[model samples]
Structure formats: structure tokens, C-alpha cells
Target: MAHHWYRNTTSGNSLQESLDELTQSQQITPQLALQALLQFDKAVNSLLAQRVRNRVNFRQSYGSLTTYRIGDNVWTFVPNDVEFSKVTALIKVDKVKIAACDDENTGSNAKE
Candidate 1:
């Protein structure tokens, strides 16, 4: 189980700037690992009967994780593998383009 900073309903494109700031300041990974179990899988059928719980409780000291989503909050899917984990992901959340600045203050002048 994993928690990603779901910035928007359609896509996570708009979260590039904030995510980068967070990644740098917090020194945390930008990628989030997601997992899904088949509803028909017999190995965990009993536990899957309830939708209330799917992941472990958020432990603040472990990782900066949350189950909340921003904006309209709708479910979407992306395909991948079953052998993934959050601890191993390294997503690049920063946008590739350089910003054209006018009176831009990047906190470079902040007093030390």
C-alpha cells in the first residue's frame, strides 16, 4: 500500500513545481508505488470484502504519506507490474522546461 500526492483529477502534471520543492526540502522520493489486488483472487478474498481498509495506517516518522486527493478526486488507472514497492520508486516530479522570469525571487536573497 502507498499514498501519492494526487494533485489533480485528470493528471499530475500541474504539481511539478510544488512537488519539486517538497522533494528537495524533505529529501524524499518523488515516485509513488501503487498496487491492486484482483477481486477474484482467492488468497485474500476475505480481507478484500471491505473497502474501508486497503493500506496500513499512516506513520508520520516513516514517510510523508497521506491518503487524500486534491480537486474533484476521481479514480483512474495505470498499468504496470505486481512486484513494485514505494521504497524503490524514484519519480521525476519536476517539469523539464526552464521558467522565463520577471521579478522572480527564488529565495536567493533571504538573510542567512
Candidate 2:
């Protein structure tokens, strides 16, 4: 027989149902039941990590930002002009142009 990996369940009802059935049939002791619950938690966390990794990889390899032309409303963070100031404000303004910022040109001096 081949080993089959279970699909990630969002509702968690599948694991809960299995645990309930096991308890009803008196198949698992209290310690074993606790272990099974812990294992289920680990599996769910692993699935979440895998999903985040997949999204990051996809974006890095094949993601592009749409161009924003002038007059398009956007929110921007404005730094305080005064020296030694720590205040910042979010202001709404019309975009002048759209510029691409890839890994090579995303430093502090890069224009947005």
C-alpha cells in the first residue's frame, strides 16, 4: 500500500471528527489523544508555512506592478522636513508616474 498525505483542512472539522470517532470507540488513551491533537496542530502550521513560501516564490518569479498614471489618487508617507524629527504623516496625492522597483533598485535612494 502507498502512503497518502492528507490535504490541509481549513475548517479543522476533519481532524475533530476523527478525534471524536476515536474517543467514542475507546481506541486512544488520554495521552495518545493529546499527542494526536498536538500532531494535528503541527500539520496545520506546516501547511500554512508552505502556502506562504509558495506565494513569495510566485511573486518573486512572475509578479509585476500595474502602471499608475498622473491624477491617480494614492496614499504616501511624508517624512518630517525638520532635522532630527521623528514625525511622519500619510498624505493623499495624485501620482505623477509609475516606476518599477526591482531587487536591484529598491534601496533608500530609489524613487517610487
Which prediction has the highest TM-score against the true structure? 2
lDDT of each: 0.30, 0.42
Give a tens-digit lDDT track for model 2, residues 3-107.
112324444667767777888799977678667766765675466447753211111122233343322222223322212212353333232232322222123
Off by over 4 Å in 1: 1-13, 33-112
Across 1-112, the per-residue lDDT of candidate 1 in tens digits comes to 2122232323343345545666778755555211112221222334333543433221233232223322222223222221222455533321221111111123221110
TM-score of each: 0.17, 0.35
User: Candidate 1 clash total?
Assistant: 0
RMSD of 2: 18.1
lDDT of model number 2: 0.42
Determine which window of 10 residues in candidate 1 has minimal summed lDDT. Answer: 95-104
For model 2, the superposed segments whose C-alpha errors exceed 4 Å read: 1-11, 53-112
Q: lDDT, candidate 2, residue 5?
A: 23
